[model samples]
Target: MKLQNATVLVTGANRGIGLALVRALLGAGVQKVYATARDRNSLEAVTALDSARVIPLQVDVTNHDLVSRLSEQAPDVNLLINNAGVLSFGNILEVPVEKIHEQFDVNFYGALNMARAFVPAIEKNGGGAIVNILTLVALASMPGLATYNASKAAAWSMTQSLRASVSDKNIAVYGVFPGAVDTDMLAGVDMAKTSPADIAKAVLHGIETDLEDIFPDPMSTQLYAAWRQDHKAVEKQFAGM
Candidate 1:
């Protein structure tokens, strides 16, 4: 859907890519943006943008009751951006099981909860869009981020299933596979990283163009191209990274 005048709800809007998306949405002239975070106080920056247009809500996507409440509270929401996620660096075999579970809770189940709770609201509003913030690792695993990769891969599969389920309802489901972004999530990563602002803008552009899967950054764009040509080769390459 067009960004202008659309009422949107963005989960995990306190910082990083979520914050950048809030900034981009406001700049894009969206009518109202409900910026949600696990803590309301953390949304100070977003609320400061425009008190009237940027409404802050305390929402932990993993909490089913809270997400249900939010769906009721924000009935006008036409776009749901499921951007909340966690990253834990570790090899799959040695990573703490809790860390793996934590990643899945926020990255996979959390997005699923948000979609389940918000789909009805969006449908009532004559259908809109659901943007699931995924990662390039969903396509291939990186050794150090194996747990995180697994979580995102599950999310990626869910995104596809959700799209098929909602296609008849006119609600567009988009999976955004971005490469390493320059956020706290990748604070010490030595690889080149794209700025959150650039990624956010590219996501908006992808949404406007009705792309089903968005490769928002240069790295992701290149990786996706290579994967399409020969996914196994790309997998082998990432395996050696």
Candidate 2:
């Protein structure tokens, strides 16, 4: 889990939290980073961060074949970051079923795809870590973001299962739960938000300190504390949001 000279691969690295993570990794002195997006051209800025260390790749995480091929390309990847995600706004009953499916595909299945492809390689390389960028809402459903909440919650469960499965393999699985961030993903939301850079730094710090579950932002940290005290109360609060 040491960041120094670690070769890492991060999905959806073109912008937002992923891009911030890439920059943070560079600052931490990582040897190389495979930054992936659906479009290679969209990654120009990310690659420009450190042209030599940042290797841009085009990949749709939903595509099994494409995700599977990444392991072959980045055989030296010891750290994998499952950061690609999608969001849809709607109540569960009224949301378009297709939109629900799309969110699940990216938020849940995409992380699974990347983990499946990389875990073996990481094991071969003598242990490493898999970081899943989940959300605070995963622990409590927000009515407005119904589908997004469900999908991320499922991923949170998967992250735990993955951790237990790989416990003896020397692979560490870290789940990051962040509250609202100032990113394009929440462009119009009028709420106090943490910067993606701060979230990225916190995530790397969690890994270095061996924190299995990371609440990266202030809001998430406070909310998680409340949830631990009374999860049902927190659930009701989110339900009304």
Candidate 3:
């Protein structure tokens, strides 16, 4: 489907990549974009855009009831971007149960819940697409971010499963594996990170080309290439670090 004249809904649109996506879609000439966040008031940036084009909707994808309700309410949506994610740094074994649970709920299952809730709506709108934002660390475990890695890994698995499940329905599911991005989520982490605008532009380009999986930046592309060619080497590299 073309980005132009499309009605889109992006979760966690108040900040970070989600906010960038709303702007990117607008720049792509989309008809309307529902920029959703946990709190609509926090989306002043999105609202500052053309109010007629960018609609600020309150959405917490982890809330199943709200997800289903939004799906019903916005049955005409053509694109769904599941960008809502939480990162709780620590090993799964050492992190508090609550933190681990929060990570899983917001990072992994949150995307899944949104997909499940919106599949019918997307199909009803004539086979739109779903994009699940992931991370390169999902391909290889990282020490300091073990819990975050685990959550994204689970999301990667879910993305693969959903891709197959939704293919027949004409609902394209794109898994986006991006490395460190310059966003609040990666604040203070010392790593070469890509700009959110670059990633957002790459994602839109991928969607336009009908790419199923998108590596939105050089860092993600490099890591994904290594993982595909020498998974063990990359694993050992992270393991050693």
Candidate 4:
């Protein structure tokens, strides 16, 4: 769908890829962007844009009631970006189960809840787009981030399920798999990471191209390519890492 005059909602708009996406949408002439964060004041960066165009919305995606309220508030939304995510970097067996549940709470169920709440709204406002910001870990689980991997993998599965069920409604579902991005989330990672701006730009391009699965970075594309050849090889490689 065209970005100009699009009413977009981006979760986790306080930082990282979500923040970059908000800026990119504004640059693409989006008329209104509902930039959401758990803390409303954290959306100051979006206010740095045209305040009239960027609406700071306070929301905890995990909260069912709040999400319904927000969906009702923005019934005209055309583009929904499920970008609110948290990563717990550690071995799953070693960490408390609560940590795994917490990751799933935000990363997995959060996206699902948002999708469920916004589907009718999107369908009502002429078919729109829903972008789920997943991770490379969904393709191959890493040793250090087992919980995060599980959460994203579940989300990736749900993305496909959602697409199959919603495409008939004319609402497009795009699964975005971004590799290591230059963000606070990858603070100590010793890998080459792409700029969030570049990822955001590529994502918009992918959306325009109507790609169902969007690999927004070279790293993600490369890994996906490898997985296509030998899924076992990629799994073994990440398992060792």
Q: In every candidate, how many clashes are there? A: 0, 0, 0, 0
Which residue pairs overlap in candidate 3's backbone? none
Clash number for candidate 1: 0
lDDT of 4: 0.92
What lDDT score belongs to each candidate, Candidate 1 first? 0.95, 0.96, 0.89, 0.92
* TM-score of each model, paired residue for residue: 0.99, 0.99, 0.97, 0.98
For lDDT, the strongest prediction is 2
C-alpha lDDT of candidate 2 relative to the true structure: 0.96
lDDT of 4 by residue, 1-241 (tens): 7888889999999898999999899898898999999999899877778888988888899999999999988888989999999998888778688888899999999999999999999999898899999998898899799999999999999999999999898899999999899999999888999999999999888888899899999999999999999999999989898
For model 3, residues 1-241, the per-residue Cα lDDT tens digits are 6899989999999988998888899999999998889997998888798788988888787899888888877778989999999888776578888888898999898999999988888888789899999888989998778888998999999999999999899888888989889999989888888998999999999899999889999988988888999999999888776
Full candidate order by TM-score, most accurate first:
2, 1, 4, 3
lDDT, candidate 1, equals 0.95
Looking at candidate 3, the ten consecutive residues that score lowest on lDDT are 88-97
Question: Model 4 off-target regions past 4 Å?
Answer: none
Shift in Å, residue 8, candidate 4: 0.5
Q: Which model, 2 or 3, shows the larger lDDT?
A: 2
Stretches of candidate 3 off by over 4 Å are none
Better of 1 and 3 by TM-score: 1
Q: How should the candidates be ordered by lDDT, best one leading?
A: 2, 1, 4, 3
